[model samples]
Target: MRLPLPALLCCTAASLLLLLLRWRRRRGLWKKVRAARQRQERSLVQMEMAVQRFREQHPSVNVTSILNLPLPELTEKLRDGSLPLEHVFYAYVGKALQMATETNCITEYLQESETQVQKAKPAGKLGLLYGVPVSLKDSIDCQGHDTTLGFIKNINKPVAEDSVVVQVLRRQGAIPFVKTNIPQSLISYDCNNLIFGQTFNPLLYTRSPGGSTGGEGALIGGGGSILGFGTDLGGSLRFPAAFCGICALKPTGNRLSKKGVVSGIRGQKAVAAAVGPLAKDVESLALSMRALLCEDMFSLDSSVPPLPFNEEVYSSTKPLRIGYYETDFFTMPSPAMRRAIRETKQLLEDAGHTLVPFELMNMDYTLFNFCVKGVFADGCASFLGNFKGELEESSLGLFWLMKSPNWLKNVLSWITKPFMPRLSAMLLSVRANTVDEVWSLHHEIEEFSQQFVAQWKKLNLDVMLCPMLGPALGIGYPAKLSVAVSYTMLYNALDFPAGVVPVTMVTDEDEEELKGYQGYYRDYWDRTMAKAFHGSVGLPVAVQCVALPWQEELCLRFMKEVETLVLKNNRLI
Candidate 1:
């Protein structure tokens, strides 16, 4: 049965050739990575020169005083001609550039913003956001800037036209000053990519400033930008806001248009993505939302409903019934996160608001069946398609899970079924689904959404308060804790309007208690949680406020209430 000498020699030569080819491909990918870094470096240098030139041209502008003014007051000043529009723009741009240098949060949009500043002269009547400097997430398209979404392949592909949201912001006199960084493929909670490097938390550099809205979080949290916009599918906006101690609103999917936001799964609608604002205060978020959800947005994209921000509902002073929960059943929140929810509930109750204990029905099944299964029914082929042969480090975990051969996955599931039942179940569930399976998954999602709404109605609640996915996770935690996104993903699955307001910070006491914490499942995720909060002291913790779909104004009102209480008590300034 032994092969002839010549045949064996031929096989060995073929194997060597294949190895050489693989090495060549890897070398090319690394070259692309280096080229991208160099390009970004050049852009940053050019931006610095532009900023210096601006500083020399406007010597007596008092940039510090301009940044001190809040968004509302700043708008009024700009309207009355007390503050020059160019001065206001440069003030924010200067602060933004400083923060971006420290955290690596900005992409290449400075030169374009300089042009925008020149074009922002006030007319007779000031627009809602006149002279305001607004930041945008990387995926949001600006006509001349590249919407990379942190992909090496998408580095130089400048979007030819602005997204509908950007156009609307401009129409309202908001200057789109900068584009922020994001996680690769805009999916993981950790924000790192080869294109722009990793964006660090301004408060704590060791931990993540959650993604894919992470760049916005760091800049706004660092007091660099007054308001910024980010898109969310699974906690992208809320998680970062919580981690960075800022305010953000994830409105119902249709409320804000998503016309030109670059997404990996752009066509996937099983769980729709939403564009929302992140800002320093709840009022700023409200202002941005009002400007974003306008007739202009609807006119550009007919899919957007012509629903304006309801002022009356947002200003309601009636006593409210609020449902509250500490955990979402998939993962137990950290001590600081749980404390944030408990304290917010206590504050609302003391403020004449009624609080009721609430639990999500079949949360575990809903997350796995609808959110997870529905989004990845095609085994993440669509999500992976945008990488263009370069795989980001953060995406390797989910990528491997989705790309593994069926036989290997089955074997792993079988082996782990005895001891690691939870993981075994997940392994079995992650795979390429059929057309019929996808359809059935969508049907189940509809049923689940209806059931959730019915449950809410039965409770007769005005709003619900819950914890975000633990306190801002430490660096490199998202790859291991992928399933821990259940809390925020639940809202997305139900299409609810959710907002996050910082209530407390992670203290030594919170970290000490987490050391002995035992999660509900006591599984791999729980173990990961235990280790993730070790160096997380002093990180901000926030709670989520949610309302039924299209009730964003109500959601913002509740967030404002919580924010006011937190500020008055000096719990968070």
Candidate 2:
């Protein structure tokens, strides 16, 4: 039966009212975001004018020579009082300004760096990084600066205290001079966001630098920063390092004080983010690790294990029993990355390290079940809470899918099963709904990790080598190629330490193979993967080094070994 005319009219009026309210709320969010962006633009202009004046006054300074110095030599000169601290700092500031201008990587200039360097000194035990200037990913807290992870609502709300990492850096006499851009919500690998715009790959203008640490990658890869801090959850640190031909370390979780390091999914410990450094070279990464694991960091945050940098483990000349895999079963690695692994394996063997074939196990259960499902146990309701009044980046589609109701996912999974079974299986894998379900998910994760440990012990492996995603994917493709991170995220699941070093570029043959790229499954995701690698020739590709938990120093050693071997081989050739 039809309702009375007045009651029907009332129902229609209420429906229209709700939509109007939604439209008004969305407009308000954009307005806040626009104001925040205007403030950033104004600050940038002021900083640029100040940089111009400094350049004119220091016209005779050899900024080029200073920028070219290696990290060790640069730090040594500053330590012995041979190089003026102010000169080196300004030189990087100049280059950093140029980098930010080119790629839109910088969020705000920490102009107070000038004041910090003036008072810098080789003052006792914690002065290992004396007079060094560094950059930070935007999610870290620095006193008096906003830690906007590219979200509009996060702007202008500066933190009251420094993050544990920042405090350690300052005490070690390293000046943190700039905060760089990240994807909105810090989820996607692409660097584009609504705030501060997109940060492009420094080498290939059209390619992505990779995220959520893409800004750090771009800056250091372009020679603007010698060392910079970044965090890796899935592949934040390593992806950018590989994509932009830099070096980075993603240490085991709970190894550092993450007190003020922000994450959208806060308090999720099943798979926590690991804080580490991105730099121009492996030695610079090692230097950063050594400085970060000091007494200052220990005292500031007690949760960090009181472990000092193990110099002996790093300096040991004993041969390693290394395990390696060219690719994983979850996603087919690009041809160039597989070649990178093989090349690295031969080089390591030449240097007296034993290499054995290693295959990844149980990714079908691990990828969507434990990681995607368990990582966001709340279905991302809690994370989505942060985006209510914010203009988020476009790449958060996955986050929303993860948050969808089980009934909806199941229906979609069933509908697509015949045509796209892998994706259907992925859709069905989002199982952690209740508290019991989450506990069960953890049990599965622990068991999977143990199985991997069993395999490692059986092989007697001290280190491992593997592929990192692809030869620098084109911009806007990482979201669909999410499965490619299986190579890296396996370590994250097991809480093992890992690092990436640039080793090879995509050769003519590599690109030719990429053209014939047939993915594991001929589904939507795979088709997108093919398109992502279509124009990726000449881009840098790198191999990943993995070690067990709490073996960060040893992991660094493995990375250094690869870097040295590759460079020596290149020189000989």
Candidate 3:
């Protein structure tokens, strides 16, 4: 087994060379690690300094401290010279800029914040949300500002005219400073676009602020802005507000004009979309709604209803009868959302409101067969229009269907469905309408709406309470896993006025209990729901308060009652 002397010498030289190379590699790696550590330290120091400067520059004023203060009080302060419009505007603008930079919440800035303040100052009076800094979802247009809608190609192309809603807000003395982030194609529930990147939840940097209204949710939730305007066709407004612990109302169709907002499916109006306000409190939402409704929007858009906000409708002495449900029968809500519903029910009942158990049997099939996939039958062509050039990593989910060989998409919809039974049934049941199918789906949707209305009439309930989503999912998971719009979509299908209101926070118990979930939809949705729940510790759990069409006042009244009861019981305010 002994080697020759030459062989031994060669082996010795090779071992020495190897040791030298190893040493050099180790030294280089160490240097990189040290440099990374230094960079991270510097970043931390910069963040702390920025936060400190923010605190010093904008010391908490009595007015700013009252986050839940009614809009009327805030407006009164601005009008009486107790609160300077400039100071309020600057303070919020500063906060939003700081938060947006730190959290990447804002998609595009008008950068004319100072000019906006100057313009509002000479008025020397309050209109409604006087000097209240507002943020809009990127899909909304602000004249001369890019409504990229989160596509990189549209970055420099500014909108020629203001969106009708933006015009209304501007007239009401609200200073719109920035356009917030949105999802690619404005399709998914995850808010990352090629142009502006992802928006993080204000409560947890690691979790998502739901999309496509996610940016507005993140900014407003982080206390960067007092008011936000977002549009919802599916669960865009409700999901973001629920995820970020803000309040929002998706009003009935034609109540608020959607004249100038951009959309993925521009003319695919099978499910109507409404533009609405998102705020820290319900009163702020109402204030914005009232201001927008005041302008007689019916004149501008013949589709808009002339129904003005009625103050008297919400002022009821008698207790309201409310219906509440924990699970949607499509899938059970996560423990936290379930707990929120139970607690909210208890609080309302304690407040002398009658709480009824409401059930829409097989609600998933109703929502699916009618509203969602059927509406997009001619396909998501309009939605898929802006995917030219390089696609962002985030936009990958939307193309999952297209990525499959057309045969696989077709085959999977048929064959692989039985294994993942519930979702398979859902996916298979989704008949992307041909020209003929589109009319049929629309007819089906109408029929479903009629059935739902009949059931609501039978219930005789003022409002129905349900989870905002099934659970508080982690950041990037909704779109990544693709199973978010359950609770909110049902409302869209029915075209009901549904509002999201936060009630409680997720608990350790909630997380622990989800470990044993055994449900029928036991495929992507089940696994995704579990993964989504994993990182969402202590996030707010919210519920949707839904009412009949044109019953927005009743919906608000019910929401106010629920909010009052919850806040008083929890001592949140």
lDDT tens digits by residue: candidate 2, 57-147: 8888888999999998999999988998888887888788888888888888887887787676555653778899999999999999999
C-alpha RMSD of each candidate structure in angstroms: 2.4, 2.2, 9.3
TM-scores of the candidates are 0.94, 0.95, 0.86
**Which candidate would rank higher by lDDT, 1 or 3?**
1
- After superposition, candidate 1 runs with Cα above 4 Å error: 1-29, 391-398, 571-573
Superposed Cα deviation of residue 237, candidate 3 (Å): 0.6
List the global CA lDDT of all models.
Answer: 0.84, 0.84, 0.74
Candidate 3 per-residue C-alpha lDDT over 1-573 given as tens digits, one digit per residue, 9 for 90 to 100: 999999999999999999998788656645544553353344334434544554576576543554444566877777777777766665666577667766777755565655777666645445776777788898898897767666655655778898888887887777787778888777777788654567888888878888889899889988888889988888889888988998999999678878789876678757877788898888878888777887546666777878888888876757887887788766657878778888888888877888888777876676656655654555445555566543343363446564334345567777766576554544544434467777877787888788877877787877788777734467667765554576777777778899999988877898898887654467666776777787566788888898999888888788888787888877754
TM-score-superior candidate, 1 or 2: 2
